[model samples]
Target: MATPPITFVPSPSYEAALRRAAELWGIQLEFWDIFGHHHVASPETLSSVLRSLGVSSESAQSLNAAIESRLWSEWSSPVAQTLVVSLSAGAIPIQLKDSEAGAEIRFEWESGGHTAVSVESADSIHPDTARLRDHQLIRIQVPLPKEATLGYHRVTVSTAGGRRAEGRLILCPDQAWQPDFLRRGGRGAGVAISLYGLRSHRNWGCGDFTDLEHFTQWASETTGVAFVALNPLHAIPNRQPYNTSPYLPNCSFYRNGIYLDVERLDEFTQSEWANRLLRSAKVQNCLAELRAAPNVEYAKVWRLKLVFLKLAFREWLRRNPQGTGRREVFLRYIEGEGNLLHRFAVYQALDEAVHKRDRNLWIWPDWPTTLHDPDSPQVREFESTHATLILFFKYVQWRIDGQVSAAQDFAQGLGMPIGLYHDLALATDRCGSDLWAHPQAYVQGCRVGSPPDDFSPKGQDWAFPPPNSIWHRDSGYELFVQSIRKNS
Candidate 1:
């Protein structure tokens, strides 16, 4: 039998490096020059190659002894190599030189030292014209093993002409876990309707905090309900006509300052003009009118509340000329909470940046390339200028936290088993704090939602980004734990 011709094309240094590597490994390489083509020998030809490389028996034995004593870490660098692994299934379909004539392309996985699995390419899979033109992407569904670890996996594609292309598979860890509170049953007790449905005469158009309080008191005393779960009371970006949905709020951390009780304003009592206005029975009349109404007109309630909130904010600021100590306490609370508060504040600042049009915070694709780098001066400056805004947002969150705690305390006092079980939205808003703070953790290309089932034929896109498993692991689940603790 004639041996296949193999061509060996190597620079002098390259050949020396190959010899050194083989010598260190106690292995011999069978270099064959087949006509003009050079090919490395198969595993079976390794012994002959070793002898040709001048690796004597004694030297090989010494190399093996040295290798056995060295730890694996000494040989394998932590820096992972990128490998292009291809996977396919179903009918084996391949594209030949002619598009009309298809051939079978064998697919296989060889995770060095592990059993190989043969895969069949699907006929339905076709080359993407745009991707092919750009030579940027390959369209193929790769089947991943259930036990694959998180990191880079190697993949190789081979064709008849000995052509090969390499790509990397980023295997992310599966850190999917059921939320602690979720395991305890969700919304099983009865669903509560929005308070916006309640009618009030005092309100300019919609319900107010007073109305919320009144309803809570009523529900607690009459129905023995301990907790009254309300939608986020976060401030709205627009005040002229507030948005009807509670889900899309300007800041989840801040109390809708509009909901503050006007009657509770301390400075209002000191103002003769305010006193006269109140004495005229306007305030009393509004409350009396709301008491008589059965349903809330949000527009009317908001109109009335808007006027009151503006007056209250002004009066409160005037009364606290030295700046309220509450601000200091709020700042302290956020700092104590660490990254949770810091990230929330960053989101709030980003929101303001979006509103002011000073900087494009959301989907800023056109931003200078340098700003993406963490160590860039531009990012540092942005962080510095927006630091106060972030703190302000944190202050708002502190207020909301206090309010929630108070509500829960009130409910507990009434002997409710669950006290105040707050509802967690299915996912965080894409442009909100979570996504903004941890952009790396979110998948931007796809929205997270459930597939269509018997319940509904139309699938839903919740418009929220699900956390990336890699990001969560790298962060040590700090964000996850903090979110749970805060809500709990």
Candidate 2:
């Protein structure tokens, strides 16, 4: 049996209304292809996109209703969904109705601090006063306090008439910081390397932080390079042929433990068991084979590092009592990371535990149904029972941070303006920790890709889910911002 081609026979007015709805929703009706040919999206495509955006576009009546509802939602809102303002900016932009002109605006910081500002109309008509129904919208610039710092904040507008709405505010600098030389029109260059491919006698099969630090120092003195650029350094499954690519990481928020230099860790230095393991004949032979290998043995390197790292962590626990110096520092770092770190640690712990029990179960979805969701009761119980294992993962990230920070400081001390330039991968492994942790932050049924280009005439499908823009906006882009902050 042959399937017939479907047809859409919308009326003229309905077609126009549909196109209008698409435009309002920021869907492009026309585009120029790679071959310089102009293309217009079909009505079917427009409707499909609109549907994806959660718009009601089933028919003329539904689309018209959706447009009206969207407009009213936007116009009646007390503030924009999100606002990015410079620290030196005079005021923050807000929208309000004439009836709610006397609303009180509150500025709340993420650090449990807040400041209040009054919203008083200047009696001047805003340019956006497109009248909606019987009410008119007014735009006002609420004065910002001078002490407002650079970070994410929240804004709430409350009126005496019982109307209330909230929005997100991101206070940032006018520009990113750069060295004086670059700001003064000086040209600079640096070498980029895949850290794992850097061969050295000291590194155990793969390049570690110590290798990077040493390279930075050598490059500063010999190559005269301004900085060293490295690959994503994102944590991966560390498996060959499939999961070793840095661009598709198991966890973007944390670094791969394989990059840790076991010989240099404070815990390793303090632990007798770690020292003996490092010097053992079996460990030495494994390290030598890995170091001399033609390619980076990702699995071997990771397995070796895991053994030493676990030993070091156990030693630290035995020596550093609760509330002690290094223990307190480690706890503080975890506290600062908050739930994000906790979730990543939980995922890593689960990954290890599940694989140990059943080697065939590689991904989270293959696990028991109750353990699939991060917020499930089973997961909570796992966290309680596997607290130390989760902490070990966090400990790995903390040490990586310390070493990278030290390298940056060392580079600056030696006159290299930027010590380590990190590249953050935009794509996350679908079967990785990120997707398992916050599945709602991504859209299903479609993979993110680029249009046809010179290199890839057929176009490219990256095999990763596109982020849920609506979800990020509603959450004030906390996860998105955290990704960049963690890499930095």
Candidate 3:
């Protein structure tokens, strides 16, 4: 066998340096493209990748700086942004930068507690040098108690002269959650179906939480289905249509309001105004049109639903202007969701405001630059002016969340083991709330896709930009972490 010639630009040594740079910066150098060809990124490819990662690799000097920075950056600091240790893993490892004569670390548990034993210096803690690298570091091993709960904790390292550093301590289970259904029991069968495709006469044009509840009830009682897996219920913008594909959404953290059955809404059921609105000839006619359509007209469906939805919101607000039971609960949800919910609501309102002003405009970037930032003064002003509108979106979110929770509860009540399983889309669209809300974290220039493959030689280009893996990790997966919690 003969060795195939590998392409290395400039020279092999520069290529080696590029490889080292990629390794330091956490860029993936070797990958199997979709075409099944084993590809090692060339020097030029590495340079381009570095650019995408916001590192200057333009010339030799800059490249050397980036590589050096990448290599020694971690050792420069005694404290990292976060440290993770499995509970099953015996002692916690703490690293010190200087290995100074007098150094100590402390643990502050988020549960209103501190470490049982505190050592005055690293020498007393576990006095051992774990490794000798560019910088001298002492790995003080601290044994954890069996009762240590799983959560985010705080770890601080201090040296002589009051020089101190702090980092997050995340304690997790060594193993993933294994439900009883998957463990030793005899195997059972269940079904996975697209939420929209589940048919029932009660649903308004598309399947909904109500329909899902009914299906789960039937499947559990008669069919003996163990669990039900659903497609992504993430929100899609109305510019879209019903966005036929649940797999692609504008935002992933929030559930799509279109999935909420309007007729089942408390306001719709209770308010005379909402009832009258629903009874109007135009509303009836629009419903008929949507119900009869062979293929869904998503935007039309969403628009029609929004009209009734707004009416429901207005009626509910009219009923509860002050801090009432419902209002407080909704506000608490907004608060619990905190800035994430508020930002998404702002984006929604801003997006709709832009669309109303000019239907031709595409996304947040296409709008006035001032409105581009979720935290901008202009956006705050927009939120203040559109307070009711933002709250209305929040109400929609609450309803969707409640309905999903109810559906899951209903499944459990019916004795289903695993209950409802929700989906998370691969990535949010570049123009959507996720990207617009956190512009700094996402990679801008390139979209996500697989390279050329035998199945489709040209390959599949999913136009949405995925979170930059390097940036996401560097930031401790800031934006990506919440989506996991929300989706799961």
Off by over 4 Å in 2: 1-21, 42-62, 86-89, 108-115, 130-135, 143-150
Candidate 1: worst 10 consecutive residues by lDDT?
A: 71-80
TM-score of each: 0.47, 0.89, 0.89
Over the stretch 255-350, how does candidate 1's per-residue lDDT look in tens digits?
454444455445555555555665567766775665566654444555565455445444544555445795466456867877656655564455
Clashes of each: 36, 0, 3
Candidate 3 C-alpha lDDT tens digits along 1-488:
32332221232355566676678677778878765778777888788877877888777667666665654445445566667788777557655544465546677887877764434344444354333234555545666755567877777777653567777778888788767768766666677878776667666677788989988888888888878888988887755532446677788788787788988987888878778877889878877777777865677767777888998898888877777897787778888998888889888988889889998886777899988778889988898899989988988998888888888889988888878877788878777788888777777876778777778787788887757766665565656778888876
> Where's the lowest-lDDT run of ten residues in candidate 3?
2-11
- What is residue 461's positional error in candidate 3, in angstroms? 2.5
Candidate 2 lands at a TM-score of: 0.89
Candidate 2: the clashing residue pairs are none
Evaluated at residue 408, the lDDT of candidate 3 is 87
In terms of TM-score, how similar is model 3 to the real structure? Answer: 0.89
**lDDT for residue 415 in candidate 2, whole number 0-100:** 84
The residue pairs that clash in candidate 3, if any, are 241-298, 241-299, 242-298
